[model samples]
Target: MVSLEVVHASNARLKELGPGLVALFVGATSGIGEYTAKAFVHNAISPRVYIVGRNQDAANRIIKECETANKDGKVEFIKADVSELSEVDRVCKEIAKKEKHLNLIFQTQGNLNLRGRDESSEGLDRKMALNYYSRMRFISNLLPLLRTATTTPPHFSRSVSVLGSGGGTALDTADLDLKNTFTGSRCAGHTITMNDLMTTEFAQRESGITFSHCAPGAVKTNLARELPFWARTATKVLYQLITPLTVGQDETGARQLFMATSGIYPPSKPVEGAASASGVSPDKTIEVTKGASGSVGDGGYNLTWKGGVTNGKMLPEYRQNGVSKTVWEHTMNVFARVEKINQERGNVK
Candidate 1:
């Protein structure tokens, strides 16, 4: 495991690299997303960043802090309810119009949704949609920009989704939505599996993108408050019971910044159509954890909170039964059906 000191050192190195980078922060109004965004601004070189969320006040506060932290960092806040696919599409289009290439996308756009599976106007479970579909929608819509965004070697591009990345459970393929059978635990597992499988498939197909879905273990953040009164109280009690394991906000931010910029997740060779970035890569001086595929320097990674890959026993069932590909197909199908219906209803946005 990489030490926090090393992580902080790597982040600080990005400052001297000079900046012509663009980053989009979704669901950064609070929690890990906010912390990570601020950390990036504090260390990044004169980067232009877009922070997206529903709360203007939180966005303004974050932007102001980023300005104070890094005088040259251009921080802009765009408000949107990203739980809806329409809104996700709209935000992507807006960004596409302004920037031709997007260098980094640090997405933490999800809530715990412990109140249970609520349905949005889009008819999908609101929590699942936010965690899986909405996040993927943002990526799919902005992939062109990500490709255009890659500027230098060593830096390449990165998309880090902060969620459960190392745990897996029996994914009921019959009920991807958990409609006929729904439980809070089951829903969480399904999304984790979806995240894992999607990122896995994406890594193979798009080697230019440095992709990761990380489980942040336990962290002190506002996400705990999203649970219902009883559930929230239970979580707090659990946190108190396991205080030693819980990561501090600043440390979590440093680790996240390491994931976003460290050399550990560089793109593949030119056969993958990207000139394998070469230069003074941070973490080059230290042993960096390999990509999620278990090989050194692969583009995709699924890591624990401590930057180690542990794909739990249950995930192999997904690969053995071709469940990962099954999920890739199912997710694409869902987006297709939803977009087609939305377009037919003149709700394309």
Candidate 2:
């Protein structure tokens, strides 16, 4: 496992990687995304960073800090509520209009939603939309530019989703949208499976990019605000009790940066089938970890907060009978329905 000090050291040396690197961070209004954005600006050389979220005040503060961190870097805020598919598409269009290639895309747009099942106006469970659907939309829409980045000078672009990585489980194919399978434990399982499996499909389809589903463990953030009162109170007490064990924002930022750049999960290049597409060997700086798809260097990576491959079961069903294909079809159907509605209302194209 990579140590925190080494992660920090690697992040500090990111300037040597050259300039003009572009990054788009979703759900960066606060918490882990915010810290990661600031760290990127501080280390990168003249990078262009986009912070997307709904809070104007939080955006302003983050932008100002990022600007101060690196005067030459470009830091911009995009205001949008990511729980809605329409907003996700709009924000992605804005990024596409501005950037020709992206070096990194980091997403963590979700909360615990302990209050209960809350659905968005777009007819999706709000938490699932933010955590799973919206993230996939960003990855799907920005894929062309990400591929361009790999073919371009940098030769790689990263897509990292900060969520439950070590938690893939058997998906209820009958109800992919959780319409009928929305219990607390089941909700967590469904979301985790969706996150990892979708990333896996994307990695297989786009061999040039690195797709990572990272479980950021438990950092001390406001992500549990939506929890019911008693649960929230209990969490607060537990957080204070486990002060020494909790990951601070600073450490979390550096560790995420390592995942973005380190050769542990080498960027892919084709070699027959994708799961075995372990092309170039890892560089000397970091130890290489095999991907969730069984490739030494390629395929979708399931990472943990401690800079290690997560030790958890990837449901065997994911590999049987074209499960990945089924999940993609369902996700696309959901997107198509949203797009059709938006087009009919004269709001989208």
Candidate 3:
């Protein structure tokens, strides 16, 4: 397990990486995304970071704080309810129009609702949409820009999904959408496994970009806001009892920022000495960790909260069955259907 001090050391040296780095923080209005966005602003030199979420009030507050913290850095808020794929497309188009390349895509949008399978107007589970589909859509829409970033030396483009990595269960390919077996737990499992497969699939296909799916352990956040008052109260009580063990929000943010900027997790064929590019000396440099494919530095990683490598129980079986391809195909079909509907309604020009 990587210590918080090492995480801080790596983040402290982000300035050596480069200036004017571009990052997009989905669901940054609150929780882990909010904290990490601020960390980026604090560390990066003249970074142009985009904050995407549904809360305008929170966005305004965060923008003010970030701008005040770093006069050289730019933080813009693009408000949208990302649970819908249409909005995701619009947001991505806006960013694509404004920027030539994106250095990082940090996604931490999710919900913890015990209620089962609340379908969006676009015909997918809302929780799953937030946790999985929208994040993948953002990556897909912006991959061209990411590839553009990689054409240069010291090439750096990464997509980090803050989700249940290494916690996936068996996947039921016949019902990837879980329309018939839609329990809260089952939906969670399906999304978790799908994310694992999605990262591996993207890694294999896109060799230049890095993909990571990480579980941020247990950090106190408003993720459970949708739960009933009683449940929320009970959750608060439980967390209070385990406060000593839970990771703090600021530490979580710092750790995630380290993962985002550190070269310890490089692509399949990284530039020489990429692992030491974080400006850390040889003694402090972290060796490249194995990716989800069990290959060292293979462009895709499944990370625990401490930024260590981990593998899900069902990954081997699902990989043998070539389920990652099915997940990718299913995701594309969903996006195509949604875009067609969006065009029909004049949601896209």
Among the numbered candidates, top lDDT falls to: 3
State the lDDT of candidate 3 residue by residue for 102-169, as single tens digits: 88899999888788779887888888899889999999999998887776434678889988898877
Sort every candidate by lDDT, greatest first: 3, 2, 1
Taking all chains together, each candidate's TM-score versus the true structure is: 0.92, 0.92, 0.95
- Misplaced by over 4 Å in model 1 are 151-155, 230-241, 270-280
- lDDT tens readout by residue for model 1, 1-349: 6778778887877754456678898989998899899998898878889999998988888888999998998999888988889888989998998987887788887777556668776768877887788888888888888776554432366788888887757788888877777777887788887887777777777777778888877887777656678888888888889889889889988888887777665755323433324111656557545665566766777878777676857776676678888888888888988888788878887
Query: Judged by lDDT against the true structure, how good is candidate 2?
Result: 0.80
lDDT of each: 0.78, 0.80, 0.85
Better of 2 and 3 by lDDT: 3
In model 1, how large is the Cα lDDT of residue 138?
84
User: Compared with the true structure, what per-residue lDDT tens digits does model 2 show for residues 310-335?
Assistant: 73564445745688788899999999
